[model samples]
Target: MLTNEYLKRVYEGLEKRNANEPEFLQAVREVLESIQPVVEKHPEYEKAGLIERMVEPERIITFRVPWVDDQGKVQVNRGYRVQFNSAIGPYKGGLRFHPSVNQGILKFLGFEQIFKNSLTTLPMGGGKGGSDFDPHGKSDMEVMRFCQSFMTELYRHIGQFVDCPAGDIGVGGREVGYMFGQYKRLTNSFQGGMLTGKGLTFGGSLARTEATGYGLCYFTAEALKCMRNDSFEGKTVVISGSGNVAIYACEKATQLGAKVVTMSDSNGYVYDPNGIDLAYVKDLKEVRRGRIKEYAETHKDATYVADCSKVWTVPCDIALPCATQNEINKESAEALVKGGCTVVCEGANMPSTPEAIEVYLSNGILYGPAKASNAGGVATSGLEMSQNSERLSWSFEEVDAKLKGIMEGIFHASYDASVAAGSEGNLMVGANCAGFLKVAAAMMAQGITY
Candidate 1:
């Protein structure tokens, strides 16, 4: 490790700036810890003070989103936009619309996006924005009202050449459409590239919906082939969450001849020992927008566990967490290990806590971090940006092929970084260093700016 002195200085500065922001602190610490070797190897980056500026976002905007509820009652919520970096190109990331959205989470997400986007080799920086309002169980009109109010302020900070936001948890096609409509109305311009993950009718890219999940499976398959001497064929996989990432991951896994045994939601998990069929899971989630427990009711052999935390207990060769942040803790990690999980991949941002990560790493499980594994979404988003710029949309096969190439490239990059760092197969360090060095070099080339 490099001098603790430099790490201490950078960490202390971040702590002082974000005194009570645990998410920001956690995100920064993880990236910094992984990139410490890089700092030691590259004195010029240190001379450039790259670490100091990397954590400080270039722009942050907070505003009130006032809308009307279904009952015609006025509702108010806080919204935030954190433009973390722009050294590469325009700011790019997702707009999460969950109740848990906050400045700390957005900052953490945006900061992570910088490296994730960089790892994609795409011309995009990083930014994340969202509101704390929950979109679930809300009527379409209610969501539209909230989206309009949120975009009223957000549109000012975003543009095709500026920051671009896509959909995250709770911000699906419906939310993106509403947000895009509002942006167009406010700006009086048909700025198609201003946001990604748009519906197909309004210039959304083909395969954008399945990019992250499909990309994750692609990366995991590549890792299995290269590192584990294993294949997805005839393997039992357990996946958490039924959202975009989880659902598509399940689909691709099934297509690869893997039987997905278990899938979960925020409520609980459903384990079908006879391998989960993708069509069933998709209908439950995409069509009905219902919970996983519903699957247990219909499938004879499937068992539903109401306690969501126990989802990790199901035995499988592979485990993928596609849920929210910090969903997997040390206990869940132990459960996964005990259940004989050989590989684990993240489909969500920081789904596994530090302790959980330690357990997996110590056990020598092939683990893929969210930034590297789940980068397919943003990579395709970048493709969408290019298509918008060219006013041409690629076919699904073309986009999927490109996405596969990107994921493969990312895995090789991370693997090379690991080998270069003498960490061998430590993908965490590989991903962090690979991403950081790219962005840090870009920042260095930009020179110092106050």
Candidate 2:
């Protein structure tokens, strides 16, 4: 229930227009509900129709992506790029390549990026693009062809100083390399700033690969220290996902004196009470591209469960949902609360459902929202963009130090915003308000645009 009249009207309008877009609606409602305080404080925003304009994207590009497989079979996939807002800076976000890619999901992600970028204290706006073409089980050649086709139309809408797309979900370094190569060939120039998450030999920044996961831990450590006078030391952490974020999160958690007991993929989750072996998980998931079940098979002490959601059932001090959107539902939230989980930080965008978040908040858990906690990846991406613009690369330690400082700053901002809003320790509200205030101020300063 949005208390502000203008905010409620804007949300109702969004619902009418995006009736079928539950994800986008959820994202919109969450932010709108959180920002009622700001709306009440600044009635000028309503008179200027800022909420209406901000909820709607500036441009939505949809096109048919036709590519051929290794067997010469032509396949068609739908691609989309939603340039949500650029009031603060250029449109910057990741290009996902999952089968679930749709206008609704992209819009939700783009909307979230607006604030996520704002939280980074960087001059980057919100945009997200992706195709429904799944890269899993595809041959290298097939993936390359798809990337080429996807970039063919996308190149016209993006540039170094304009929209910059990086990797998300199924899109990784291999896919980024393919897309970067296509963009370079299409434009006939080496504009490295056009993409992040590229190979080190290309324009990718140091610590970019580990930024999100490592940053999750850093943010969590700050929250723990501030709220509970504690840290990750001796905490039993359970992380969801076997991808880059989870793997590196596990590595960083281990380094920070925490034991990561579980890591999961879509198919299932593996549990090792003695703390997961980061080396083997990385080798299996990153290098071999194998499923997480292999970890249980190789290590007799571990057990593999077919249901990935059950990973939350294990008792732990902290939980990091690093997998995907809405992964932690109400039932999972209940499980975490019942199991004595004190903190839940999102390493993936909108990983917890509204119900799940409500449960966590009511239970007095220190919840770190994705926009602030997961901003590390894009923060480092911003760093990559700076490096590319200067044609200079910083060392791993340099980038890592910067990433750490940014994550800490995000925590404090969210914390202070929460306190100022009278919500005390509610990070979701704090993050939404903090992130939105920055972009909203910039929008107001720039004046109205028809």
Candidate 3:
């Protein structure tokens, strides 16, 4: 379906080889479509087979993770680590612990990470790892045992300078703590830099948890100011998901004078017309680990909707989808446009389906792709890596300021790339072109050595 012959051939080969990996296919097709103009402009990319090679991962590791549950029964799970590209530096990504963890999903995440990491202007490459073990409803010991077993094999494949993994999905500070402890036990090395999202007392960077959420707003604010001469002040924002990203985004948006009206979990969504109470959300998700429906029960003015997909239906000036991949479908996207939503920024990996993206572009919505908008988390991890390597620590304000600066730079990079490609203000293509331009150059210069 691509107009460029070289890009089309490369994509077709990938589609044939990865027939079952729809998520990976969807991610690759999006990037391929965006970079076609760049490919035609620079024949060296085709000569170097950059697109073809970039579509394939450098390495994939899978293994069995066996552990004991509270019932005194042994359970088995699958673990995967996809090192998609290391053309820039060591493989760097997150470790997701969810029932949905699979090779295809990790490939999609890792593939996106290549561009995401490049957009940060950091030295880290792209990688992702996770397991099919659900951390929910599991005892601490059970989770610890699974972490140890998963790390028993994963430890050999990762390191401080090789591949450093962070947290995603069900994996967070608790899961990371367990895995880092196991790695230390096995290697007898206190290599704090080997992993990120660590507890603050142990080389973890301050503001890492808030980085992704705050960074998303920073990027959105920059995009709005530059593209529409507007800001987040007095904006009605609708956000999805009740996890760390969503919770922190609610906090930062409120700080910037925007009223975030909605948040959801897998069960459903809660809509608060007066603005979300982030303190309650943080305690509910981060502490009590309760469902989002409780929000309506606590606040009489708010209403709870049983359908999680209906989050986008709430009318607002801006929409931030911080949930899982494809959470917003074509219909949901149309609803946003109809509701007068002028901007859409992703806080999750591939939160919008390709069809949904089409709606955004056609409607002239200010769309910010996940790779560029959500790069704050990984960028802060890079700062953590620097701190660990240098045996130094930075204050929360210092890290937050750096994160803000990096996000502003990312916005300009994408905007400049968009203008250069004759598609000004289209951040979807802007992010892709900006990200691809850097990696494409790196790949061509490095030759086909990967």
Q: Who wins the lDDT comparison?
A: 2
Per-residue accuracy of model 1 over 1-450 as CA lDDT, tens digit each: 335568779998889978878988888898888888778877776677778889899999999999999898999999999999999989999999888888999999999999999999999999998989998788889999999999999998999999999999999999999999999988899988899999898899999999999999999999999998788998889898888999899889989989988888888988888888678888888778888888988999999999778999988889989988899999999999999998999999999999999999999999999999999999999999899999998999999999999999999999999998789898989999899888888888889987
- Model 3 Cα lDDT, one tens digit per residue, 1-450: 478999888988999999999999999999888887788899988778788889999999999999999899999999999999988889999999999989999999999999999999989899999999999999889999999999999999999989999999999999999999999999999998889999998889999999999999999999899889999999999999999999888899999999999999998999998899888999999998899999999999999999999989999999999999999999999999999999999999999999999999999999999999999999999999999999999999999999999999999999999888888888878899998888888888887793
Clashes of 2: 0
> For model 2, which pairs clash?
none
Judged by whole-model lDDT over C-alpha atoms, candidate 2 comes out at 0.94
Clashes of each: 0, 0, 0
Which lDDT value does model 1 have at 442? Answer: 83
What's model 2's TM-score? 0.99
Local accuracy of candidate 2 as per-residue lDDT tens digits, 98-145:
989899999999999999999999899999999999998999999999
RMSD of each: 1.3, 0.7, 0.9
TM-score of every candidate: 0.98, 0.99, 0.99
User: Using alpha carbons, what is the TM-score of model 3?
Assistant: 0.99
lDDT of each: 0.91, 0.94, 0.93
**Candidate 2: residue 323 Cα off by (Å):** 0.4
